[model samples]
Target: MSAPDRQSSFGIFQALRIRQHLVVMAIAFAAFALQAWLFQHRLDAPVPPILTDFNDYHVVGRMVAAGRAIETYDWPTLKLEQIVQTRNWSFMPWAYPPPFTMLVGLLGLLPIWAAYLLFMAVTWLLFYAAMVRLAGRATIPALFVILPSLIINGKGGQAGFLSAAFIGWFLVFLRERSAKAGWPLGAMIFKPHLAAGIGLLALIERRWGAMVRAVVLIAASFAVATLVLGVEIWPAFQKGTSTASEYLWTGFYPLERMLTVFAALHRFGVPAVAAMVVHLTCAAALVLAVALAWWRKARTETVFALTVCVCLMTSPYTYDYDGVALGLAYAMVLPRFVARAGRYELPIAVLLSWIATSNYLWSGLRQYWYGVPIITHEMQLWTISPIALAALGALVIVVLRRPARPDAPWLRAYSWMAGRKPG
Candidate 1:
């Protein structure tokens, strides 16, 4: 075939690919719209489950705004049952720190319903904007609409969307504007566990400026919160933390609802101590992986993706919505995955995508399928952790096999730090 013939055929293929992507995006958006509408109407229910988590934030926010921050943490004196009855809201222990309470208090200024919608909308927008900036416009469908985590987060009114958005932008700016990256890293203080792995990775990479800025920002946030809410809030939070930890271990929170290594093990009838040991071991391994990747000067994008995955793996408390960060990680490495499409990579990608979106489907099946319930309730949430672990393993393999581009800036920086000549 002539060169012109080959070029024309390639152009046709590209156009076809674009059209296919557009079609998939259209379907996803339509599905999301329907879900949103159903959530709003709640059918026959007076209150939709979408407000479950948000109500906690809204109530706590109102309490903080009304100078009742201390009461939020003082479970015994707070009379949570009475408060719930008065407010007509669900019971949710206020486990977050004072800094988070301050932010929530601002949202409390609005009506609960309006605050819930606005919070979700704002976080979704931030997530989309960060994703577009990092992965480009073509990747929006996969990260924003198709990912089941976003849907879980939207419905649950969880902080996962906001956390994922912060982490996504942090990764985007980490290499080029290291100091500026601190802002998003600091913002992730609301869910400190989610940011723990990345924090360690930053330390390993000797990103001192970013680390220092993040520390200062976080400290300032806490300090400001203390000044506004009073120092007693910290001790109250500490007590709440202890209570929360006990609740987690005693199975007060259903194992079927938690998507963590510890919960997965416990669901299988492992002793609580043994499950915790396994969980800690896995968390350590994930941290080590990130440290090793940083030491080896792996590609910045690859390291960032790994950091996100490791964060989820290590976190003691993770729900389906928290997988939004995992989706962002997948989006980060997607361009490279496309460039070097392997036989196994496509299948793995498809499998992980399905797993990310399977929480609700799995729950429904467990509830309605008699056989499923007979098998085990733990299987509902346990299924997510293994798939995520496998995906992380696959990601690590890909990163190790793919050498850094010689001219990548991070490679040069690493070389200088190690006293080696930049190749």
Candidate 2:
């Protein structure tokens, strides 16, 4: 072949590849735009009682701003439902801590619709920033727009984006700014279940400074809330927590909407006691794995990624929207996976992405099975369980492949902090 002809052929191939890339990106963007429009439209429409998670936050915020924070949680479920209906909003149980209510209440000072829009905008920005920090600029469009979880979050007015942003940035800055990392970790008190593993990791690593900071910050948040709202807020929150726990335990919250192993078991007709035992056992195993990974000094990104997956598995109250954190975890680990091209890396990435975006699949299944009870029941079971477990399994594999070395420098540094000599 002539050199000029070969060069021309190579150029043509490169142009073709670029065009293909552009085409895929264009498609992804279009999907994002369509999803966003649908989500906004849904937000504008009145939500059903069964699907009013966002309204709960807004109402709680309004209560807090009105100095009725304690009353918000103290109201009986039926009374609360009545009030919600009277106000022409959907029924949504308020179960978050006072700190979250206070934050949302500040937003509630605005008109409800305006507050909703602003809250979503701010949380989306935080989510985008966190993604960029963890995944780089390239992933922003796909994650912020094309990911089904984002759509789920926006449509429901859920706090998943806020949790994702806090957790994502916490993981990114954890190694370098250990002390400062506690702030974002502390902010996760808004959804305390998500912070459960953060505290566990801090304690396991004997990161006393971060632990102290997190405790102080969390305490301060509550203290400020009490001062502003009144001491009664704590007891109200406790009562609400108890009610929430009962709802979860009794399956009143609907097993089909949850993504945890416990809920999956419940949906499959496992008794509540048996499901609880299985769920607690799995949660313990995941926590132990995370502790071991940190103790052995796994790579920061790997440990964070593993923890995020394990966190999702640990909590019984999670929904598909909350899997935004899992998406962030994938982002954290992607560069390493791509660089190494490990044997299972591509499959693992695909599985995680599928799980993160599985809502689209589930939605389609729901549409197809619209009025078929038996099939719909099976679909609910499948959607809530299998993909989540698959994601957890894939994460376990990734963690096993990327085992921490005892002699890693980070362990030595940690040992010094713990007043022990590194072996």
Candidate 3:
């Protein structure tokens, strides 16, 4: 090929890619604008209407407002009872630790609407930033805005977006062999168990700088909590953790899903020890798998997939909203599979994403199985469950079966080819 012909071809390809990006961005902006407008003008409820996890923040926010040191376990109950006693609705006390409580309290300084906006913006930004960093250049605008996990996170008022983003960045930093880059992980301590799997992976990989910085960041959070909420609150937090565990296991909370070993045992009247054993077994397997992969020097995408799978499997209480991590998980595996030119992975991803968006999102139609009830809820369950399971199976296969290579790039931004190892 002539030099001029090659240059012209490259220019045409670049222009086409740019055009596609613009189209995607335009569509996403329009959708977001429509959503915002509807939220603003069509509301029948009060401003800042609480959704799923709003109570968590509300409990802590009120405590901060009342001048009470937030370290007390009783504060969550106090906040819950304060509303529940009069509202005739059950309130689970704020279950987050002192650091998160204080952070939410800070959020309470703004109007609830502003807080919500800030939360969404920060979470979405972090979420995509992490995906971009981990996947390299394949970070599509449509993938960001239209992902089912993203919708779930936004709808449930959960912090999965930010958590996934932070975890993604941490993994990227680890891949780069940078030590201090993992400090952002401390922000994820709101759900300490999720951090556990990732931490173990870092340690196994011998990323001492990342490990040390993560620990220090968490310690700093505790120190700040003590400074603001007092030392006495620390003991209360410990007790609160135990109390919350008991409450959760016994089905005292709303929307209990007992898929975890602990929850399953509690549901079937089995001993807690058995559940703990199962949980430990799964966690150990995950850690071992990740360590083996690291030893073989697998791609960053592989490591990320293993980390996510381990976290979910080990978590005793992963609600549907927490499935937002699946977006990151899918991102990790999708590129490598795509490189293999598989027909199924991307389509399966699209379908699972559809289900993910459809089942629990706020903005979707809830028609009765498309205006026909062919066996009612049973049919719906059959359709959704099998599909979800199949997608999950595909994800697992991709993560476990992929070959290792020594020369893969560290993931730096969202792309199918990021951290790709030569076969």
Candidate 4:
């Protein structure tokens, strides 16, 4: 009844919540320990299944070292390199653009083990630093929230960290200046699909300086990759994409492993045309939401977070490891969402999302490596997509329902964008 009594009760409840978060984090750390051990254990095998994707990165890097960088796009040649280098094979092909090929090709300059460690080490540091910047005051909690995705990315030795870190920097910088934002956007040339959505977001928001810089950087990178690797690399990469998708239609990539609505629908035996229609429809809706969010002048963080969902939904080949950007986006927005909702359920939903993005790595390890039949292909096709849809809807709803504060300095991220004048 008294104000002092109520204040005391609120403090106590807050303390309780903090303690609960710590406990969950402790369990997560323990799980991470086990996961690290499992990754190490798999490495003892002559051809570890865990390295299949990384093998693609490393072997292609080796191709560059051996003066055959462009050949990485040659499916048989790349597969042969994997067989020779790591004695493992992947159904996935090397569809990365030349700039990324060159980056990883430099990794081929090192021994496989050293390359893996060094690549992970550098990117791990950048990823943490970038996420810290994104999390701002919520750095510690954000780390825990993204820990699952971090584990999954590390386990598979994927480029999730590098790509996600780029995204983190892009979001942080976009709020500061338009041109400065383009640097990270350009760096994402390695994964152009991911960058494309973000680029479009800037375009819709009318961040012209950023758009110019990103275009220049992208063009320069492509020109350099072309000069160094040869003109043939372009066609090779395209042909490989065609080859891979043919396999995809035949179920080479399991729907459970992919995080797109198209994959989920196709998994359930929907017709290919129907699946594409559904996916494109969802993508259109999300992109439109992002445009509207920006037009309404929502905070930069909220808009960028929504953009992440759109990128994942629009991409046909996103995997659990590739969900790192989404995970980091969730972490970046969690504090604000919690503050605004002033309730428990939104946080819980976010946590459930982390769980959803995390399980694929564990499930694959169990079924393919550890001989445990815990999760099967038939069961998880719908796991990650629903979260993407839900997050998009929630963000759009919140953006529309609640206007940004009148005094917020970031009324517009780019003053020159869309004819806005400073106060």
Model 4 scores what on Cα lDDT?
A: 0.68
Clashes of 1: 0
* Local accuracy by lDDT, each model: 0.67, 0.65, 0.58, 0.68
- Residue 34 lDDT in model 3? 51
Candidate 1: misplaced stretches above 4 Å?
1-51, 75-91, 141-146, 339-348, 369-384, 395-423
* lDDT head-to-head 3 vs 4, winner: 4
lDDT for each residue of candidate 4 in 8-75, tens digit (9 for 90 to 100): 75565556545644554466445545544554455567645545466677778888878887787778
Global lDDT of model 1: 0.67
What TM-score fits each model? 0.78, 0.75, 0.74, 0.78
> Order the candidates by lDDT, highest first — what do you get?
4, 1, 2, 3
Model 3, which residues run further than 4 Å from truth? 1-50, 69-72, 75-91, 141-146, 254-276, 341-345, 349-391, 394-423
lDDT of 3 by residue, 1-423 (tens): 697986776565566555654564466445444544443332334443333454345445655756664442674556554454223223455567888877877765664445556666677667766766776445662255236655555654567776676777777777678885568666678787777667777777777777778778888999998888888877777878788777665456432222244544444555666767776786687778888887899877777778876766577665555665656666676555444423454555566555644444322333343564122222222113223534655665764466632333422122322222122
lDDT winner, 1 or 2: 1
Between prediction 2 and prediction 3, which has the larger TM-score?
2
Cα lDDT of candidate 2 equals: 0.65
Model 3 residue 213 CA deviation in Å: 1.7
Report the C-alpha lDDT of model 2 over 1-423, residue by residue, as the tens digit: 697986776565456534543554466445445544543455456653333565666566766777777777754643464356333444345778888888878876875456666677678778767766766533442353236676667666788889988887776677665677788888888888877777777667677777777789999998998888888888888998898788777666645656677887887788888988998898898888787877888877768867886767778888777877767766655444433344454455555565645654565576666764223333444345545556645655665466455544333332332223333
